[model samples]
Target: MSQQRHELLPTETHDELARESFVQALKSHIATRVSPGVREIYDHRVRDRWVSEHGAEPADRHEVREALSADTYYRLWSSVRRSSQHLLWSSVGDAVTRQADDLAARARVADAGLGTLRLDPDLEIPWYNAEVDIHAMPGGYRGEYMAGDVSVGAVYDRGVYVYAMGQMGALNDDYGHSICQNLLAASYPEFTPRRILDMGCTVGNSTLPYVDAFPDAEVHGIDLGAPVVRYAHARAESLGRAVHFSQQNAECTDFPDGHFDLIVSHIVLHEMSPAALRRTLAECRRLLAAGGLMVHADFAGYAGVDPVTQAMIDWDTYNNHEPFWGPMRDMDLVADAVSAGFDDGAVSIETVLTGRVLQTGKQQRAGQLTLLVGQA
Candidate 1:
């Protein structure tokens, strides 16, 4: 489903800080319109044409992408959609950059509770991170220009709303908020977590809500981007939430064995290589306390979805700079969880509806989604 039609877009009145110009806003709107139409054309026209000529459907997203890659409509959609993504960043970055120093200063003294920020200069950034701008951002998420800099993180905090066309709600924390409403509230009504970990938490947008959900829990957010974590720390402070932000990789962490009551990630699977994902899961299993839980919410089911839809999703794999999107989504999570030492019978999945989704008046979305869940 299109995030635009489902979730409301940010308006001039709602987010004056973004300062979107008429040209940039128009480009972003055009992109939002193009993204869904690309899928519509694929589902209605191209897939039908392929079936008519071949007598059989394309087996997967790759084949679908290949078949449509040469089509005029598909080419135009890719070009315009890609340009719009850049334009969205430009609109937010232009405004956010001007206040980078001020943001950094605020973040430095922003914590409201017994929270902390930890950075490891000796830590090595993974090759996937050092290799390319994963999301078509000019310098990438981890890029840092100076000490105590929050420019990249500030851009991300606002850029994501622009990218999602404000579908994530006012603060853009609905992705995390969804877990509390769907999985936490519905699945484990009586379970009370003592400690929580948000792995690969970029700006802690998805990390902050667990504090509100379980006020007594010691919440910690981890990622490789020092600047983002710095920004996240300040953000949690500004929101009056207690979250310890740290710079670390999820594949291997410094936490002791069985240290946390809950571990979670939101839409983080498609960002890493399969090996990294596997390693991360294994580490998650190691970090969870006995009787604790681990759950990760990802995108629309990859292998389970129609080929045409899968092809549309693959647009990220090629056009959006998400190199591992295809393999990560296509992975066999049950088997992967088993490989990670999670009990075979205890491993399960759920498609949780995000909170913003509920406000869209489409409560049925709760069942149509999926989340990979495991227990220690």
Candidate 2:
């Protein structure tokens, strides 16, 4: 199935939609049919060769990569996986570019009087963001081609649904939805937040869930991209969600100290540099009121995974333009949070099952999301 259509999403031509669907199918095939072979090759072929040479299995993800790099099957699969990513973006980008003017116009009139959008032209884009197109997404998240360009945001809103292979639910909102429904409700039943903030809220996919989950709470979302926040505000307004959208760096937002009762981010930490990640955690501490909860959700760290598995998961860092993926996995998030002024006892990492399952053409995959949770 395709992504749920919203006003801010570009209208794909019939052929464009088919191309996007093919890309999705190819990704699903890779995940189900081709990717599983990596483990089999590593367990039997790569491991046998490594043991013959060094008298022990690959010691770390580095060695695991070295071993896999030599295997013809692995190389072929890797090439295909990388190509698929480029194709995914090309397919989505074309659709957005085709209707750039239309999208900008729609964004201009999308307000349903639900929320507000604030932008900062002088806000410097971080070096990390300005230097790389994090996902090889064309023009990245901040590109503004025209006076009121929302094309990049439209592309992202559609692209992520495909990139996640529909595992993030129909609206690509499973992360925020799951956190609110599964984690917060069970953990802090009596804690009612008056103001909530979502950090690195690209296109506001994860930010909108808070509006539905906490109807009375004042919800806000922040991102470094001007185009993204512009589209995010419009998207929220079209969806009847009252979410304040702003263009600001998460590491140094203008919100006053103790301005929020709850802070959350979804899979955004891996996109940041080490310094930014640390500063953001500290910023979260500063923005949160006493007894407030801070939850940054992303993939779990690579402390206990097998070497081969780690290498496999880290392939994105090398192939998909996610430079910080591997480094982010190696970080000690709990310790970092403590260093960010959180009490040692107040922070911990927990893994929670996704509130939804990924359904792909008769295949169902259950997923787990990790949380770096802290309390102020």
Candidate 3:
């Protein structure tokens, strides 16, 4: 019996190493297989369309498309693979759960902290009313959306994307904020913001970045989910960031009129319905101090990309449970922003790379479009 145990132990260790090696190899293989074709598609279809229609320099779209395509492919692949691995992890988690009732106890403690906030579950927020689990998260944000239930919304947000590999889907909201900060700093150097507000900041991921970006300014974040707000506040506190998080709807915020120098939404707009988006935009305009800027970082339609790229973006909306995404992308964001009260010349869309740089034509390419409003 002792000899058998020793032999099995060595075998187990070998298997673990082999599995890890296989995963790494699979990632490398997927990258090599998908990247080149994606790059070609971007260079030909995406770049040509942007330059021809938007008056961007020739080859600009090409370079941008290559970088963006790689990033998108990597993110999508990682998420899918992670989901695949979850079957194993889930069983392991179950075993761990059995062994350690401590996790449950911890979750209960977290739940207690969230109980102070009153959230209206029946309030019927239009943006969250969707049938499909957007981004393939098993339970979408609205599925278990509840106040005082720390595990529901919080779990859904973290778990739904559990299968997503390597911070794919930006892992957490903080990553999204970091992306925004980097994009703004690199793309729009002229805009010096003083007061910033991040809407739908569930965990202050989007809110904390602004605080870091502009230390001189006051940063605030608001969300309707009380548990999420509580969690966000706790997280921010733990991170040693002084961010003011409130439980409120973005459409009708408690903030004073014209209070913020910059109003930003990271991946929040598309979740909203058309009417809600319009209302949010109007609220953004109303809350912006005169000459304050609104920087919205989200999806733009793949009008110029190849059929495959277009299909990939659209597939997530249909297959991955993002019902509003397709509709949101179809809407004219620039037009919507203008209708909300920004001047005609105030809004401009510029692309930035979300992934590694790759070869392209002479023109510089932007990976994703960042719509800057309020000034040129």
Candidate 4:
């Protein structure tokens, strides 16, 4: 048990550690093994029987949901998974509140004046963010109750590790590193970017990896959450990675036109409304230099999915506070890219690697995860 939270009694530290560890262990079991067993039973026994009796399989995820809504196994699995997710955040929230002041102080003195964190007091938080807490996180990502509150950021940083259950690797930067590798090695072997940007970077978990991927490039990350950027800047500085983190909404930024040669986002699009997503894409175009590349990776892995898989995926939308997650999966990403002024031929899906990043990349808009890649 780490005394990571500041000014805490040893008893409090142990209590927090015990409680969060239990939740993380429970979450991992449900996510990796228990949930899969339920799915197996449904696929093998319930689904097959339903298909035989009903004279056809489920037409879509909706049909599957309706059919299995009352099933005991389905109900139990769904409830448990959703509860685990919520518990993960709440547990972190308790710890973060105790450490918020400490995190803020550390951010102020980190690295002895290294890196930058610029937050706008008047920055408008998008309606999409205000309406619902993404991923069941309390107060969402941007909410700050005090002057130098980092509770939301600290919770997110700690919770994601438990939420991911070590699947995201030790640094938790695989999401960005995998995307960068696939794009650099496979998609654009000839392209070498000089400046890079990451949109909606929560704690620079996905932002700092680009610093290593492009050693010579100036890496910048923007998000609407001020505390998260503060934490991200400090984290990057501590790791000796000079990343510029700013609190700016992705839909609009103050950067000069054609400022970045490469722009990327990780798991950001699904949390946005259609209109907001459009504006963000257009903004990407505005921020990108001529011949620059843009890649937005998400968990919209629809490739090879049948009704059963889709219905399982859909549980997150309604239960996890992801209002736009489902629609984002069905969006015509190539058409959207073209509408945003990207070359039609250049608009394509790159391979989304496995063992970490989910499959969204596919030729026909179906894959384990998705990658929307194009040039400005």
Q: What total of clashing residue pairs does each candidate reach?
A: 3, 0, 7, 8
Q: What is the lDDT of residue 154 in candidate 1?
A: 79
For residues 1-376, write the lDDT of model 1, one tens digit per residue. 2222111121233354434544346555554455556667777887788888888777777778977886788898778778777776777777666666777777667767768899988889898877767788766768888779877887777777665556686677887888887788888999899999999898888897799999999999999888888888877777677898899999999999999999999888888889999999999999999999998888755756877768877888898889987887778988999999999898987776654422121122332346889999
Model 4 worst lDDT run, 10 consecutive residues: 358-367
Candidates sorted by TM-score, descending order?
A: 2, 4, 1, 3
Residues 119-199, candidate 2, lDDT per residue (tens digit)?
999999999899888888887888888988998899899898877767777788988988997789888888789999999
Candidate models: Cα lDDT each: 0.78, 0.90, 0.56, 0.78
Return the top candidate by lDDT. 2
Error of 2 at 368 (Å): 1.0
lDDT of 1 at 329: 76
Which pairs clash (backbone N, Cα, C closer than 3 Å) in model 2? none
Per-residue lDDT of candidate 4, residues 1-376 (tens digit): 2323321111227877678888877875666566666567777777777788799877888878777775788888888888888788877778777766776777666753556789899998888897788898998888788777766777877787666555575556768877777666666787788999999998888887788877888899999988778778877777778898899999889999999999999889999998899889989889989999898888655657887778878888888999898888888888887898787797787667734532221212222346788887
Model 2 misplaced stretches (Cα beyond 4 Å): 355-365
Candidate 4 CA-lDDT value: 0.78
Error of 2 at 134 (Å): 1.5
Sorted on lDDT, best first, the list reads 2, 1, 4, 3
**TM-score of predicted model 3?**
0.64
In candidate 3, what are the lDDT values of residues 106-176, reduced to their tens digit? Answer: 33343323212334445545446445444554334444333243333344333323322323334344345
